[model samples]
Target: MKKTSLGIFTVASLAIACQSGNQAGYDASGLDSTALASITEEAYKSYVMKLSSDEFLGRKPFTKGDTLTVNYIQEQFKQLGLSPGNGDSYFQEVPLVEIDTKPVSPTLTFTGANGSLTVKHLDDFVVSSKRLQNDIKINQSELVFVGFGIVAPEFNWNDYANIDVKGKTVVAMVSDPGRYDKSLFKADTMTYYGRWDYKYEEAARQGAAGILLIHETGAASYGWNVVRTGWAGPQLAMVSDDKGASKTEFEGWISQETATKLLNLAGLPKDIQEQAKKTGFKPVPMPVTTTFALKNEFRESKTNNVIAKIEGSKRPDEVIIYTAHWDHLGIGEPVNGDSIYNGAIDNASGVAALFELAKAFKAAKVKPERTIVFIALTSEEEGLLGSEYYTQHPIYPLKKTVANLNIDAFSPLGATKDVSVVGFGQTEIEDYVIKSAAKFNRTVKGERNPTTGGFYRSDHFNFVKNGVPGLFMGSGSDFMEQDSTVINKRKAALGGRYHTVRDEVTEDWSFDGILADIKLFFDIGYTMSMEKSFPNFKPASEFKELGDKRLAK
Candidate 1:
């Protein structure tokens, strides 16, 4: 009788939880395949083909392609009956400073007590800047070669130690020095210090006149052209830093070959970059003077974040957000006779999934207790700008926001028996996913490339940074535990094609995988919306404090 009474009380408690809000739980009867089936491979293929067509002009941040891109998404949101997300408005303006550095000739003249050595561009080095200033010249400033430009206090690692590089040029490693020396930092995986934004911010913090990251193909991931195409445009960032641009300035990345030649002149050992890996590695001031002239132009423009809401029948203010970034490399150099960067798998798949989820929610007649937001963010390709701005300037208080479920680059490669979470173990979000995937006889899995740092590579990082635990998931590589070799090849191949023009629409995709993944994401949103308490990040997650702070409120 005691157990029965407690069980009854718990049931009654759940009933009360439902009464407290209008967010609807999933029908025990479950979802239908009809809508999932409607989200066809052919449809996705067509959308990607159109967007990636040469017409869109490699969807750089502020190109005309952005105009067409945002409008299309806004129209879709309007049709979905989603309410404006950003304060009675769908658009959040992100003001950016675009810096283009076209050095007449980038010359690095490194001098020792003995002699000097000069490095050439492309063959020896490459450089670009983020400071919106025109033509910064460093004629007499000393060049300090810091390993990775990191100052991680948590690790007791300080690349800047006691020597200040203010007004000097920093020739640093592009990625994390920790990556190079695993004994000291998160080896292979990118720490916050590995990010380019971190480098620029650190430089500005030190008052450096310029910062240059030495990029290696292995370290920076993409080639120089990827950096060039994205940087050589009107970039959009928040107007200030507390609100925006406050902490960052004068940033650029140079090739490794360039750094090697300079190191030779500085009398530094070429093979033992490992020396800088240890503690007490002081900043080396090679007698190198670098000079470059940068001239750039910009036309600031407005783009809208596509926002639509399905009001919860009971909890109208609390929300479950479905986010997808809608921009890509617009148009660039032709590859294999094609110049358009149709971001088919890069994100059109993710956006298409966003709509698919919205449609599924609307069709579910069982309305949620919490409002559901469908957001197609802009300028994600330009460095998660739209989502970052949204997190900073939220339409709804994040305290009331249940979760951020992000969709990006849903590869349509045939059906996989499992789903992959980018940050595999960070949250119990995977629990919701596994419970939901069970309906379709699917399984959940961790990303194959945890070493590659896939989790930190998406827009969800913005939400993660803000304390709202976010999830980035995609199709699993294990096709029913299919040959691991095939999985490895396919994963590598798909990763390669992501930012390339080759990623356009194809008849090669099987919608079963896309549908399965979307269903999984939808199930996640539904579960979060129906719960009484917001889902908190796991103990290991860095965002735990954010949730605790909100709960304290």
Candidate 2:
């Protein structure tokens, strides 16, 4: 059972504050206003329960669940009087290819001066390929331990210095060297370089045949099971123009235990990772060679992005997008005899919020000057594929799009005194968030765990990459309850259920927090839509240049 916080402010106060907030640009006495006011706890609860129900079959893309999920969202949009976000249809077809890879017997074998060692799949290591090939084989590729596998000229760090890894396999650590040496990167905060995506990208750029990241739970901020499950299922990717030719043949992870044993076999120091964290560290050539054969069964399918729009009264072409991924792990390995991975809090809540927000807008007496687009994206759990595709083939030009506000897994642990803004300080949108949140007697805080790279993990990152400001906010732990212990325990419990089958809707969930967050987001987006100018990335942000270039175009 979940614990409820008995706070200084009662639930009645929270409801009154949220409903009585200044509806500045909004029509004060319209159906929309009434709808917004009627976003009651019971209504929100019903939406979540139905969306996350087992009948949806976990809402995985390319399955019956996808059909039901998209149909339901479309029906809701129609009921809300929202027109198709696309030209004439509520659906945007995203072409995708699913690769179901099963490693051959004796999948990974390492041979070194210490003799041969075999690692079991999903036990000692988890491997997957981005390349679109039926059969992939690495024949005794030389293994070289290349620190963090980072090549950042700005940081003056090159792990591949004085080494040629072309046609060879590179074994690298999960995060950047700065994870250990605070002064190296962004101190303890993770940069894009620390992301596994960057490691694989850097390896592919250097012509490496394969890349293996050594997993450390603390450094990666997730357990090995996450890695195993995420990569084990039918991996989906946007059907690349080059068919993933630019990607490395293999990208995988090895458990810390497996890594230590591999290091011993290679006659390398077990403390090599420690040594690599220092300044001016060079690549280490391990005496190990690896061989692996992977077979992939491929299927091509198309998924639909449920997009609904509220066109602006004036600048109809100008758009503000609200995004959330509708896809989850699907029916996967059962946990506790339950095979369905009902992504209740993982996203059903966000989609439910999407519906509620749309209703609120539709019922408004007056619409904003800019278009508001609500997009229920697909294949986010697969790698933000839906949003990525939208950016590539945007319904509206990126230059005309003001900003993106994304809602993913919201906290159900009751109302809080603050809201955590991921990627805080990167854009001016945060200022709007602060102003809107303050009306509720709440504050805005930067991400509490920056090391997890939470900012880039969600659908908003795709927008940020394309030079549009995006905001991904979550519930803050600073609850109304004086004691922090209650909130901390709640957070810990949520973390355990994340990405697991146990992430189902529970009766104990308090919609007060979710309702507050949704209202804040609605306010921010409404404010942006009413404004005359677009929100730009801060000058210090790496994405600022891209935004400027896109806007100029």
**Highest-lDDT candidate:** 2
- Mind giving the per-residue lDDT tens digits that candidate 1 earns over 1-553? 5335334544543453344334343333254444444455565555666656666665556778777777766677677666676657766666554444555555655566667767665445555555555555556667788876788888788888888787788877766665666676665656667777777788878878777777677677777766655554445555553432343334566666666766777777775356776677878877666555555443445565677788898898898888988888776767788777878777777877776677777776466789998888877876788888888888878888788899988766667877788776576676677656655566666777554466676788887787777889888866753567755665555656757787866544556677778777876787677678777777866667876787567
The alpha-carbon deviation from the true structure for residue 485 of candidate 1, after best TM-score superposition, in angstroms, is 9.4
Q: What is the TM-score of each candidate against the true structure?
A: 0.86, 0.93
Candidate 2 runs further than 4 Å off: 1-35, 483-493
Clash pairs (backbone) in predicted model 2: 32-363, 32-364
Residue-pair clashes, model 2: 2
Positional deviation of residue 43's Cα in model 2 after best superposition, in angstroms: 2.1
Backbone clashes, each candidate: 27, 2
